[model samples]
Target: MQIPFIDLKTQYETYKEEINKEVLNVLSSTQFIMGPQVTKLEENLAKYTGAKYAFACSSGTDSLLLALMAIDVQPGDEIITTPFTFIATAETIALLKAKPVFVDIDEATYNIDPKLIEAKITPKTKAIMPVSLYGQTADMDAINAIAKKHNLVVIEDACQSFGAEYKGKKSCNLSTIGCTSFFPSKPLGCYGDGGAVFCNDDALGAKLKSLLNHGQGKRYEHKYIGINGRLDALQAAILNVKMNHFEAECKKRIEVGSRYSKLLEGANVITPTIMSDRNSMYAQYSIRVKNREAMIQKLNDAGVPTAVHYPIPLHLQEALSYLGYKKGDFPISEQIGTEIMSLPMSPFLTESQQDFIVNAIKA
Candidate 1:
């Protein structure tokens, strides 16, 4: 049996009618830029996340860029983040001609080690950006405390963790500024690229709204430098439809993830771990293995597809070489860069398909 890594087909089958109707409504209206749908989505998202405001954007990358712009990120300013995350986490910092201070990740959770954060802070450190890698939030309480002590802004890169919770709080609500992606494969995704920024600070929220629109607080009046980062109206309408079933889908994702952990107990792989006080939305049920490449090859041969969450650490990427980071800088992230592999995970994955995947890996 061929087991797809993510069963988008099954998910679509469940929400076909609603999604189609929403898409058609957008096509018919043709108010295709930032319209009523985007406005409604922002309101709903803010309420759902318990944030004072939410700003929709073209993509998660744009959300981060806009967040940095709102905070006046300048050249030579330092933004500390984990080396184990997607390039966007570091790229956004670098794009503003700022410095990205690489922090090592915790071996168990594969997230930034907060204990190591204080030692990296300096007067030039403008912000601390911690990524919620693989749908599990990093230790936000600890990270926030450190940020407070150093007077640094905190931006939670919640791209893979929109519905996830840490302690009793949601992912985006725990930080000064939170950003999430709506890439097609994400847990809370639209058909195309989309993203949102979350913040409880009213002033910051208003500033973010302006920053995403070329710093225009009012039409034809530009206040500060910004970008054309508005979310597509069609994408917003699509997301609104998706949100109607989001809570239910998140519950199903939890159940599906639990089942995978239970069934893969004896398999030759290191299953993901959940922090005691946290809950993951399981954006991608990733695992660490002895020989990831060989396991990938075996799974491929058996028609059970698998993928790596990331193959290289951001600090080591050629684009960031000017940052002068060497291979041994972050031992844990480098180790993870070599072994982490993601399995099929979605709200609609069937037990039979999951079993086929597990059996293939075990065999």
Candidate 2:
């Protein structure tokens, strides 16, 4: 049997009728951009995440951009972030003509290490953007304490962790400004590209709304310099339907992750670690293994598909070489880049399929 990674097809089939109706409604209205569906989704997202306000945008990357713009990130302004995450985490900071200061990650959690952040702070520091890697939030309490001491802003990159919880609070609402993606495979996703920024501050929420619409306070009136980052009505409509079942899906994901850990015990691999203080959505059940390439080949031959969350850390990527980082700069990130491999993980994955995959790994 061919086991697929991230089975969105099963989810689509489950909600076909509702999703189809919503899409058709948007098409009939011809309000493809910022339609009523977008407003409704934004409101629902805010309520779901416990944020006072939410602004839907074109993609997760743009959500980060909007957060930076609202926080007034200027040229040479430094935003402290992790190098082990997707490039978009650092790319957004650089796009605003600001610098992204790299921080090492915790080996077990794979999230930014709060202990290393204080050393990176400088007079030019503007914000701390910590990615909630693999659906688990970083050490937000420690990071927030550091940020508070420095009077710096905190942006939680919850793109991979939309429905996750940190210390009894939702991941996206754990910081000053939280951004998440609704890309097709995210914990909460739409049919296509979509994202949102959440904030408790009413003034900042208003600023984010203005920035999402080409910086417009009113129609044809441009305010702060912004980009066309509004979420399409069609995508919002899709997300609205998906949001209805998100909580149930999250519960299933936790079960899948827990089972994987139990089944893989004593196996020659390191399963992901979820802290007791927080619950993960288990966006990707990644593992660290020796002889990763050979293991990947074995899984492929067995028809159990796999993927790598990242093969290279951003600090070592050629694009950011000018940042002057070298091989040993972030040893943990560099090591994980070579060893980490993601197994097929989804709420829809069946017990039989999981057993097959695990048995193949042991082979």
Candidate 3:
């Protein structure tokens, strides 16, 4: 009676034939590293997302790192971001020895509050890295305006919102630089770690390509200090297969997410909020409840699994303690950290499974 949290297996079964074929092709070709599929996948992704260029990378974390490195994020530079997100959001900033300035999130969307961003900006600020958390984008129009005024770069940490749109624009295309993950659990995932950087600027695009491939302007020429962030051929092959069905899957994700909101209506829990100008990918159908521990236990007992997207705000984390932030610094992120719980979410979730999960919540 136990239900899977992500249901990746069900999705795999649906595309079994195509996925197997692609894997076998990659295996047989033995072009495991940067095979033909890598370029093909990048081209497919660029066309799909409407980005001028797409640079495939090793992982989502590397995608963010590459974006930062491409823009020359030096030590002592400051980057503003939400504290409620996964550690990778801030960890990348710290890894470059840059300070990740914390900003509070909006209560309704669980995203960085643009109204609070301007107050945090200073001369040392290099970029405003806003995360499109929980498969929805932050207020990019406002965020972009702020970044433009200060002449700072805007990096959309869209790792969780690959299929999402904001103000009629795709997530990765909504900022100066956008990054996404192709981790198997993401909305559009590969069999293993893979990610891409999306950008419209030609110079930055060229720089990103070189940065991901050990700064190779050509085969052996080192241009900038870069990392081993290339996306290999096998993952590219798997993603190419997935690309054929991604649009349909995104539609199904919306259907299932909408159904969940309807079913959970007046269930005394706060459901996700999608703004009018954009649509979410619903990477997580998370709900807010006052009794989180009790609710998680009840759901698990009913054979329904639940998870917290995050348990601690980044500013309050011990690893980031040297930033000199405390418990009350980001109250909204801290409060939501305690209450937000993700339910089973996937394009393939059936109505009956949703009904069962809702019943468990009501009980």
- Candidate number with greatest lDDT: 2
Score residue 102 of candidate 3 by CA lDDT: 91
Q: Count the backbone clashes (under 3 Å) in each candidate.
A: 0, 0, 0
Tell me each candidate's RMSD, in Å, in order: 0.9, 0.7, 0.8
Q: Per-residue lDDT of 77-151 in model 3, one digit per residue for the tens?
A: 999999999899999999999999999999999999999999999999999999999899999999999999999
Query: Can you tell me which runs of candidate 2 are displaced by over 4 Å?
Result: none
Shift in Å, residue 331, candidate 2: 0.4
Looking at model 2, report the run of 10 residues with the lowest lDDT sum. 185-194
Q: What local distance difference test score does each model get?
A: 0.91, 0.94, 0.93
Structure candidate 1, residue pairs in collision: none
Tens-digit lDDT track of model 1 for 255-333: 9998989998987788889999998988889989979889999889888878898889998999999999998988888
**Candidate 3 stretches greater than 4 Å from native:** none
Model 2: per-residue Cα lDDT over 1-363, one tens digit each: 978898999999999999999999999999999979988998999899899999999999999999999999999999999999999999999998899999999999999999999999999999999999999999999999999999999999999999999889998999999999999888998878889999999899889999989889999998888899999999999999988998999999999999999999999999999999998998899999989999999999999999998889999999999899999999999999999999999999999999999999988
